[model samples]
Target: MESLEHLTPTDREILNKSWAIVSKDMQQVAVNIFQMIFEQAPDAKLMFSFMMKDYNVTDQDTKTRIVT
Candidate 1:
C-alpha cells in the first residue's frame, strides 16, 4: 500500500478534505456489502455485523481523540 508522506502540504490538505467525503461514501459501500451478505448468506451476517461494529467503534474513537 502507498503512504501519503510524498504529498505536498496543499496536496495533503486536499486529500484530507477529499477523504472526509470519501469516508462517508465508503461507509455506504460497507453497509451495502453487509446487506448483500445478509441477504445472500445468512450465516455470514454475524461476521459482517461484527466487522461493521468494530469499524464504527474505531472510527468514533479516532474521530473523537485524533481527528478533532
Candidate 2:
C-alpha cells in the first residue's frame, strides 16, 4: 500500500471504498496526524507556513481544504 505502483486492482477498489466511507472525517484525521507530527518534531510546522496562513489551521476547516 505504501507503493501505489504495487497496488492490485482489488486493493485499489477496497481503498477507494474505504476512503469514500471515511471521507467525511478526513479533515479531523488530517489535523490529528499533523498535530502528532508537529508534536514529535515542533520545527516541522514551520515548513508549512503557507498552509497555516491561507486557512484556519487550528480548526478542521483548513484541514478539509488542504486535504481536498
Candidate 3:
C-alpha cells in the first residue's frame, strides 16, 4: 500500500493543481484518479476505492444542464 507521503514535490504540485481545478466536481475527479491509478498500478484499484469510500463521492451524472 503506497502512501501519499512518497509523492515528489513536482508530483504534489500537479496534484494540488488537479485538486483546485476539480474541486467543484470531485466525483469526476475521483473517477479520473481511479482510472489513472489503475493504469499505473492495476492492483491498487481496490485500495483506491476503499480509501475513497469514506469521502462520499458520487458518480458523475451524465445529464447536466449547462448555461452559456
Candidate 4:
C-alpha cells in the first residue's frame, strides 16, 4: 500500500495504458467464447430466453446478450 503511494506520474500512466490494452483483448476473447458456446452446443441457445429472435412469437428485444 505504501509503495503504491510513491508511484510517479509516468508509472501511473504506463499502468493505465497496459490495463486498457489487456481489457480490450479480454473483450474480444469473451465474444469468441460465446460464439464457440453457441456453435458447439447449438441447442444451448434456447437456454437463454433473453436473446432476440426472428419476426415471430413474443419476446421482442432485438439485442444479443453480452457479458460486461
Candidate 5:
C-alpha cells in the first residue's frame, strides 16, 4: 500500500484545508458519504445496524443519526 508520507507538502496542505471546510458540517458529509457507500455496494448496508433497516427512508435527520 502507498504511504501518506509520499504526499507532497502542497498535497497535505490541500487536504488539511479541505478537511477544515468539511469538518464544519461533518454530519451531512458523513450521511452523504454513507449514502454513496450503500448505493455503490448495497451489501455494505448489512455491516451497520442502523442501515440494515429501511434504507429508502428519506428523512435527513434519521439518516444523520447513524453518524452521531
Candidate 6:
C-alpha cells in the first residue's frame, strides 16, 4: 500500500480543497462514479447482488447502499 508520508503539505492542501468541493454533492458523485464503473466494467456489477435485481443507479436508496 502507498504511504501518506510521501505526500507533501501542498499536495495534502490541494487534495483537501478538491475534496471539499466534491463532498458538497457526494451522493451524486458516488452515483456517477459507480455508474461509470458498471459501464466500464459490466462484469463488476455482478459482484453486487443487489444490482442484479431491478438496479437503478439514480435511485436514492441504491446510491445510499452503494456509498455506505
List, residue by residue over 1-68, the lDDT tens digit for candidate 5.
38888999999999999999999999999999988997898767757777556554345855633321
TM-score per candidate? 0.33, 0.51, 0.37, 0.39, 0.67, 0.71
lDDT tens digits, residue span 1-68, model 6: 37878999999899999999999999999999999998898768858888767554445755534221
Find the candidate with the highest TM-score and give its number: 6
Please give the lDDT score at residue 33 for candidate 6.
Answer: 100
Give the C-alpha miss distance for residue 6 in model 2, angstroms: 3.1
lDDT of 4 by residue, 25-65 (tens): 89787888889998898657667777526213343497544
C-alpha lDDT values of all predictions: 0.65, 0.73, 0.69, 0.73, 0.77, 0.79
Identify the leading candidate in terms of lDDT: 6
Superposition TM-score, candidate 6 onto the true structure: 0.71
Candidate 3 pairs with clashing backbones: none
lDDT of 4 at 48: 70
Lowest summed lDDT across 10 adjacent residues in model 6 is found at 59-68
Better structure of 2 and 6 per lDDT: 6
Worst 10 residues of 5 by lDDT: 59-68
Cα lDDT tens digits for candidate 3, 1-68: 38888999999999999878889898988889878987898546445556554344334576433221
User: Lowest lDDT 10-mer window, candidate 1?
Assistant: 59-68
- Stretches > 4 Å off in candidate 6: 54-68
lDDT of 2: 0.73
Per-residue CA lDDT of model 1 for 1-68, tens digit only, reads 36777778999999889888878789787788778986797546345445454332334645632121
Over 1-68, each residue of candidate 2 has an lDDT whose tens digit, in order, gives: 36987999998999999998879798998998999997898657557876566444344655533321
Candidate 1 TM-score, true structure as reference? 0.33
